[model samples]
Target: MYQLSEVESNYRRLFKDFLRNSYISGLKPLLLHSPVQYAKALWLAFLAVIVVWTHIVVVNLTLEYIDQPTEIHMAPNLVHVSNSPFPAVSVCRSNMINRGLMNNYAFKIYQHQTQYEGTFANDSRYPPLDLERLTDRLMLLTNFFLNTDGKHLDIDELGQLHNLLTSYYNGSVYSVHDILRELTPDCGDLVVRGIIYGMPVNTSQLFLKRATSSGTCCIFNYRRPSYSQSPGQRELDDAEMAALPQVVFESNSILNGIQFVLQDTHQDDYTLSFLTNTAFRLQIFPQEDYATVQSNKHGEILVDHNTIVEVPIQPKFFDSSAAVRGVTPKVRRCYFPEEGRKLLNQSYYSLDECILLCRINSMLQHCGCASSPMAGTALNVSYCTLLDLPCLMKWRGIWNGFNEYPYVEQYEEGAEDASSMSQCPLCLPNCDGVNFEITSNVAPLRKAFNATGYAHGLLKSLNNDRPLSIIKLFFKLRFAQSTQMAMVGDWVVLLNRFGGILSLMYGFSIISYIEIFYYLTGKWFVLYYRECHKQKNDSNKTELDSSSLHWNE
Candidate 1:
């Protein structure tokens, strides 16, 4: 009983010393007064509120740090440069196939079908084809190769068409890419003339062929490798990189920008008139990045015939700092180019490219082939023919829903079913890249031609009766806004925030926290050791006393 009492007294003394010396604001006042005093009770109540509020705030801060560790904000200053690299201009014909070539091919196919029917009069293998229906089916097949909108057939209809097409076309699968390339108007025929910075450029020699969702489009000032290039041959040489086009910041006039006179050769085809627009679709993007129909779909501008469209662009560059890059990709919500290359095994990485590749991978896994419009050939995957159209159409929902980098709300909503859904979480936004924001204004081509001081001589070489569309792309400002990713909730920042809250509530510093921890744990450990030693000495003395009694007896 005495030993137990002594232990209780020691514990009380230790606790009293802690309360008296504590740096906490209300603790000392509460310790000095009697428990019955109102002041002591008020101090206790006030300290409880402070502790609860501080705990709530600290917990919220911790949760915020865990959920969103970084933030994207506009830079303090605009980046002004003497020379900005010109953006790549991709021009796609709304009507992808040439009307005249399609008619000629359809006529030839109709003749072949007639001859086959006559030769195999009773043969069940060869189905008789109606000329008009054959033409419509041919157009539908070509539509699958291009990014034509709102012309989808049912799976059974597509399968039957594919079977008929395979049986009629020499018992072999027709290559859609080859046929589209053959029927589509050449870039030289479509892009009649090109000019940059008021100087005439060769439309044939300057433009390179790039396959987009809109079939094959001609690209200008694009420095990246074509999608058809093999993975091993995708890298650019030093000479090629050095020779990339660069333009000085000139006036925002239409004459100071890249200009193209586009001709719509397939405008007269009424069969596909409703399915497509009678205009040229333009996509303007960073010259260093690959341009795809999916990536640049939102930025596409359509110029109607006899209209001159002026597009003034402002470029914004986004970069991630070293502090942000030090965080994991999930926390930062972006990937450095090198990190993307390593993860995706691509020569370059962009959000669009990543999404495109993800879709292609999903298609390859499900259908055992990829559509020709996608970059599956680079991976040695076979292109899906007309026969695979049914399979491809069946999984269209899964393909369309395969989002790589979703927004915060989207991610949270889908977090529960993320494993089951077709999502690519690894494909985040590129940490360093450029984006162009464009504003377009359209004027009548005749009006621009009728006005005085238009001396480009575009009128001299072209007939006024033909439908011609003009597109101009230029920078409207010399300076660009930069957005940067910054570390907002790193360990150091979290610790500082937590310390500030504690200090505000309890007047506690790091030393005060350390002192409390020492008293709570370390001092208890020392007391426990001293108590064990005292008991042990008592036990030894008892043994010695018993031994002396035995010897005396």
Candidate 2:
């Protein structure tokens, strides 16, 4: 420490000597002796400040200028999936009554259930109604009344039984007889699937919950539908047909708000056939060092990857964040590649693939499984079970940029699930690379009933006594597809090296102002401090001499 302080002291002395010499030999001796020279020096200093100010303004303006020229051209027609950076499908549940019931049930169980009841419910997460399992004695008693009884129960008898069973439910019991008689099934042969491709928000799990009677048993039947495609074979009445659930994609909706509803029907044998096709086109720069450009005889330079492209200045929006937060710009601005980070990656993936990969990897990490809607026989990934849903939802909430507490408990680092979805190098998306424009047309599919077709044979073989119902829903989402070689990209080039260096005369550069500021202001304070110290010492000496003469007299 002592040596370091000594070195610093030596450097300070050297700097002081240099400053003193410059003032004494150069400007001070010349300017102080001559008022004309001093005025000239003052005038030059004032002018230098103005020049520096002008340079600062020029730099700010130049930063906003379009230095590079960009050529916009539509490449060959491409075919791809609809899951561009974001393809959201919002599904409104047609079954409002069932939805209300389920919402109430979920809330009641979650809110009022004891720890033991919660554990029991978790253990009895079975299909249809994920309720707590009854003990053997209770099960046997239910079986004796429901299935083992020799006599078929009348409506009155069933109502009485329901009352007995739900005595502890505080008058919230649903009548089995009334539900059976009143509930109308949806249209037969209407299979549906709504798959969200680009964003990580699970459209499957988001079911619309309408507020109804808080404690009524009517809320007991609602089950949140997962995004899925199922065969719809149950025949529906006129009201059910009109109220058929439909998947919607509104232009104003965001990715996280996407939703999907699965139809609920009674017939276990009913079958639904749903078909979906998606594609996307991406415009990007070719990664190769050299690209071929065609030009006409008119000296028109055909632009390609290496060609300089001029784009307007604008901030890029991610996840519709600016719009959601009400921070969107009034005037739209375009950003150039040179001005910001490289948004696109030099990889073999199409834009859709890159975005989908991001979604898939996120699901794997947070949800403990891949998206069931995206995963299939071709994709060797497990579907997220009902147990893993809360965990997935919490993770997605965090990723969606919502500044709220996580709904699920935190997972321990290096846990089995955490390690399962480790850093995926391949799942990264080019955040600012390219934007996508998409359009889709959905139509109901009609099929002629063929009794002698293969459908008859399959149904006959599966169950001859009961006729099978078939519901087929067809919709195709066609995205603009481009080959690996043919990409939807434009050329980006840097235009002015120094914002027209030659246009400004006298070889004046912005760097000169920066250098002047550093030299003048950076060390000027220290020099001032030393000068003030010298003046104080001279005054103290003069005071002491005056005091000594006065005392002698």
Candidate 3:
């Protein structure tokens, strides 16, 4: 007889009891011991099958998980107002003295008071640089006299004037007569060569200057689309609504050619300030035609979208090769790829962001006046004049590799200068998932100066003695779209559905679940524990007998 340790005895008893009650001892008999018990047990098995079958067949229902919650972010907005929002104010306070040449072939404009105008607002009193004033300033600075003796001037005389003007004005100033003669071969015989003689009009050509500071002080107002129909909302006719500003997109994705015309300008020294809302509103598909853009109780726009997503701020350049994930789609669209250009340290950017920056750089290099949308750059931003536009278009065409010149077919492919070609490749947007339409307008804010209390105060503070003749444009933007969000099938709903399936499959109810749990946890465990206890007692008695026999032997 072998003497058994207490631990070994306990394990032996446990195994013996498990064998007695387990399936080996006739599982079907134990499960079908009574009619009522068998019925309950059978119903449970059927319910489980129903749970699995319904889960697969139910195509209308789906389980979705919201990976990212929706949130509102306040970030700096970068906007482009084409056609130079900030024009240069070249005020020429000149009562000029003109000297006429023989047959009035050329004239000298001299003695003009010249100074810069307000960068934000062009004061009506301090007008911009007109043709006459510019000509006068050039003549006075270079000390060049009129060369009107003949249509064609002596080479020596022309060279002297050109050299003097170029040296004095840093080559920025050029005589209109010389330019006309060079452009037109037969201009020598023509009486009119674009320059007005004798009494000259002191007109102003405004140039947009770079911002001295970062903050743009302008008020913004938001309004629903004219087609919007809500309670207390009145639909406006086309005549009453302000027309959207014309945005010209001929060659590039960048909305770089926007023209804001100042209608009914009664004064020359009017100041214009650009206006836009502090935050951009994005509205996805809704029953209403337009987004409900009213300020909530918390002063935030009430936003409702199918799926809420988070987006990063713009103007941050990025490299294309980075493996960063979880970027929102809206943020991704802001990046534009530049093939030949690379930032010093950054490696990623949104599509539109990169293109806009490239557009600004391009305009700065070619037009000599950078768009005012960009700030804190090394180059000073200024407005491009109508005269400077032709040069801009030519340079832009050369860089973009798409010449818009009427006679571009005549030029040989490799004959054009390679240095002027665009080093960056063109970036196109993916239109598959993205589609948006915007309606906006830029209107004069002078009427608001009297209507609104804030504007009245501002008017009094800024222009107390002077009349409120500053030119200000109010910009309004409305955006709408459709977005998808991750969804999860509700657990409660699934449980109810499972219960319904079980009821249809068998006459089962909530009590069936209770019965199954009780049988598995309470009844089955109690029976097994008692059986193990009896086996343990018997094993212990046998072990004691074995120990006694061993001792006796």
Candidate 4:
């Protein structure tokens, strides 16, 4: 590849040099020379033309294999009709193609990113790509298709990438934007436009603000029709819990335009209606998203939808948060897909939110790992599945008989004026007078999970059992979780922590000691590359000099 480029550069350089010198160097004598000489020169020129054509053909073919869009196995195009049941219809989607190519082609973003680095292939250790991975798209053709390769690709370059795609989708076809949002009980309508590799993603867009006038009655719209609770249409056993709705509403914030959708196994057929009737609108499409999502937790391409709504409020470019012209980001899982002319409402998950949930669960997990919750001490652990850890485990006692480990319980604080422990379903009597009352605010959350039947009521009963400091800390956490205000503050703090960790990781990666070893070993490879370039240039120069000398003779 390098040789071919170098040769092309050398040939172009020689041509330019000859043109510049000819006008000033008395080249009029050549045309006046004998016809025999001109005939021989024409024959030589014809051979050179053939050689250049061969070189161009070879280089083009090589790049085709290295970097290009694979032909897309296009799905039948969906068209909207005026008579459809769901009204206020606006249709938009994107596809890429070319003249000669018979079918629609898409760029396999995974394969593309992996191709640059030798990361993926049919290797023994890794599993195969499942159905979830296939439909999830990473490469989005944006209004301004940003090329991360640090090179500008006009029409010519895109053609080389894939002749098929280039022929079609040559310019902007759909004025659409994407946004990514999380698949929550409340999240329904959203879309994703930007790319997150190795993860199944979907998107939606909606306005976000602190809920309500007194900051209490926050409005939300899950971008879908409200789920009218009827047994015939679908079953609402666990997910559509009426008892624990307060927990879902606790951290309430107003998102202007999101429609709710439910996803199991990364499949979206269900959605919650957070729109018109803000209160009891827990919707579901098919509940297929859970099964689909859980099936490939290692990673999967989540196939979800992004709602495209042309808002009349304001429009702006996507550079920074300030430049973003919308309600201050609600900081949910979803993201906005595009930033150009045709605005898009996208749906996606926010990494920060996931990390927050992970951090919260991390504490629970660590706590679980620490104590033997068997005889009078630890709770019994249940293995739900491969990915799921048990709720609690029991403490193994000194005697042969294993004592009863209480369910996971909360402990009230010992500090002065500590908030009262809120009660949950699992009310185990404390042997040490360790009273753990569940707070009223979070009590609804506990109820919601229970309504779903999977909740093993907060196995809390730790009241006054341990140290004062630990008790204070646990109470403080409960307080923060109870009050939505503190929860938001915690999220911001987590963001800062995450940013710091990322900076440290990046700072160390380039200068790490192992890199030093590779630097030493690979320095020779770079040196050899330079030498090769130098030799090729010299050879081209020598050939040009020889041709000049022969012409003079």
In model 4, how large is the Cα lDDT of residue 420? 16
Give lDDT tens digits, candidate 4, residues 1-553: 8768866665554444443434222223333446574664775566456546644654654454234212112123322211111111111111111111111122342343344333323223333333233222212222111111112323332323222221222322211111011111122211211111212223222211111100101122222211212222122322332222121211111122122222111222222221222122111111111111111111211111221111111111111222222322322111233321112112312222222223223324544331110110112232111011112211111110121111122222342211111211111111110111221111111212332332331212312121111000012121111101112223344445444443443332223335445444564456557768898899999999999999999
For each candidate, give its TM-score against the true structure: 0.77, 0.28, 0.23, 0.16
Candidate 1: tens digits of C-alpha lDDT, residues 336-400: 98998988786777776777677678778988887765552356677787667656665553444
Model 3 clash tally, residue pairs: 31
What digit string (tens of lDDT, one per residue) describes model 3 on residues 474-535?
A: 12222112232221233465557656665665445577657556555776666567666877
Query: What shift in Å separates residue 242 of candidate 3 from its native position after superposition?
Result: 38
Top candidate when judged by lDDT against the true structure: 1
User: What's the residue-level lDDT of 511 in candidate 3?
Assistant: 74
User: Among these predicted structures, which one has the highest TM-score?
Assistant: 1
The CA lDDT of each predicted structure is 0.68, 0.30, 0.30, 0.24
- Model 2, which residues run further than 4 Å from truth? 1-39, 50-353, 374-378, 401-553
Candidate 4: lDDT of 10?
Answer: 56
Candidate number with the higher TM-score (2 or 4): 2
lDDT of 4 at 480: 19
| Collision count of model 4 | 121
**Model 2, 529: alpha-carbon shift in Å?**
33
lDDT of 1 at 74: 93
